[model samples]
Target: MRVLLTNDDGIQATGLHAMRRALLERVPGIELAVIAPDSNRSASARSITTRQPLAVDEVRFADGERGFATDGTPVDCVRFAVLGLVGEPPELIVSGINHGSNLGDDVTYSGTVAAAFEGALLGIPAIAVSQQAEHGRTDFRPRGRGWAYEDFAAGARFVAELVAAIDGLPLGERTVLNVNVPAGEVRGVRVCRLGRRIYRDELKLESVAPNGRKHYRIYGAEPGYHEEPGTDFEAVADSMIAVTPLGFDLNHERALAELGRVDLQAAFARSIERQELAHEG
Candidate 1:
């Protein structure tokens, strides 16, 4: 199978390389097209480049593997591949082995998950993989000098196995599997729902420039999650891989049914009647 492997982390990121190595070793007869951002685009969400034209460069990895790097967001990488840059549309899209865990409500702000969403939007099966940070480490970046590819080996291996067995999995055409791997030993895998986040971020003014520009910090602290049962956060806390199926449908069916009974048309007519009465007076 042909898989489009991309990530929000740059092409040189250790996590991405670890996944690449795993796919090459574990998945039989798998072809990979690696395309990703030239630099880190973390927390970019589902954003695509519109104003400026994107540039793609052929980059050679330290292991002598060549891949494409673009000056665009993670979504753009998927679009770039589907739009014939990689010869044809890929059969699957695997994003990440990301630097940090994209859990709870925070997945909405993750470029890793956003890439998978784009692939699912295009009728392709997609998976977003993330690894939990070490204990008490809010800084999701590499520790000390840097992280070796082995730091992400466990997550990469699991994803490779999942990809190989995807034919037997019951996945919808427009569904994305959001996977989060624990830092230490793997307990097992759990299918769960998203947990709510309790944000403690405070807005603070850092400094004022001579040009009257103010610098403020809002997301200064790491957010916490509710300890709910059968949640993605809860599963990861117990050192298990959390797999949450995500869809793009944002409609609230219950609210739709309730609002359908309201007299919205009469309310609109009343507003128009009030405007006419005011004009005459």
Candidate 2:
């Protein structure tokens, strides 16, 4: 199978390298191509380049493997790979083996998820893989046992196997799989939904700059973990691979029906007219 691999982490990240090596070693008869950001573009959420021209360059690995690097977000990398870089679209696009977990609300802001979303948008089957770890620590090599490189490699191989077995699969319609593996020996796999994350009061107003303007830096307090029974967070905390099926359409159909009673369209039109009249005055 032809596989296009990409990541939110920059092209040079250890995590990205690990995943690439794993795919090549584990999956047989696989044609691999990579297109990733030139630098880290984490938490960039499906954003596309419009204001500036995208720059893409050919990159060659030490083993003579060729890929492309782009000065854009992960979504842009996927688009470029499918439409511009590769001669043909890949059968599958796998994103990440990301440095951090993209669970629950994190998926809404994740560039890793966004890259997979872009692939799904273009009628390609895609999966986003992430590993949960303690924040700020760089080297995951020490954690390399049940929840380390080898474990993630095993998960990637399992996903490939699953895709191969499923026939007449729906490639289009923005279907994606978000997979998060716990850091350590995994218990098993769980089909889950988005989990909740609770953050303590970490936002603080620091000091101003030279111009005497007030500035604030949002610092994170110690992250706390809460596991609700059937959610992804619970599965991960139990050292299981959490797989959540996600769709790109964000519309809340029930809410649309409830909101229809408010005559919001006419209200918005009148509000715009009032603003225009005030501007003229």
Candidate 3:
């Protein structure tokens, strides 16, 4: 099977490289190609380059596995690859093994999740894996020490096995699996729903220069799940892998049903009559 790997953490990110190695070990007989951002695109979400053209560069992983590094968002990388950037559309797209977990409402602002969304839109099965960075989960070994992927090696391997095992499972249309693995040794994997991520955010003004240009910082809050049952945050809190199926459709079924009860034929007819009268006058 052919697989396309991309991430929001850039081409040289440890998570991306670790995924490549783990997939090679577990998912046998699979062709792999990597296309990701040239730099960190943490919360870029689904933003794509439109004002200007994108740039691509050929890069090699630590093991010499070559890939493409693009100056675009995570979604841009997926669009380019699936739309024939890396030869033809790959059968599957595995995003991330990201540097941090994408849980609950955090998924909305996550480029890691956005890449998977793009894949799902292109009719491909996609999985996004993330390792928890907070709650003492991340391993920070100085600056440029180059051991970022070591801590989450096991999680990356698990993701690869999952991809092979769940190849033919029914995931519905325009759906992607968002997997969040807790740091350290994992206990088990659980299917769960998204949870709320709360934070105390405040706008901070840094300084004003002589030119009257003011600088401000938008600080992002951390994930604080209320330990809700059957939620992705709950699974991660318990040291288990959280797997949530995310879909692109945002239609509110409950609202649609409620609106069904309201009769609008007369309202529509009156609005049409008003328009016709205005035109006649």
Model 1 lDDT at residue 68: 98
Candidate 2 has its poorest 10 consecutive residues by lDDT at: 135-144
Superior by lDDT: candidate 1 or candidate 3: 1
TM-scores for all predictions: 0.94, 0.83, 0.88
Candidate lDDT scores, in order, read 0.90, 0.77, 0.84
* Tens digits of lDDT, candidate 3, 141-254: 113334466767878888888878866677898899999888766899999999886755668898999999999877743335555799988888788988899998999999
Q: Please provide, for model 2 over 1-281, each residue's C-alpha lDDT reduced to its tens digit, 9 standing for 90 to 100.
A: 88889998888766677778777876778888899999989878988899999998888987788888999999998888788588777888889888778887778888999998888888788889887764232121223333345646656665666555434654446789888877656778999998876655466889987988988868445444466788887777777888898888889999998998888899999999999999999
Which of the numbered candidates is closest to the native, going by highest TM-score? 1
Ranking by lDDT: 1, 3, 2
Cα error, residue 131 of model 2, in Å, equals: 0.6
lDDT of 1 by residue, 58-166 (tens): 9988778889999999999999999989888899999998988888898889999999999999999999999887743323343444566776888999999999998
Q: Give the TM-score of candidate 1.
A: 0.94
lDDT of 3 at 3: 91
Clashing residue pairs, backbone N/CA/C < 3 A, model 2: 147-184
Question: Residue 1 in candidate 3 has what lDDT?
Answer: 83
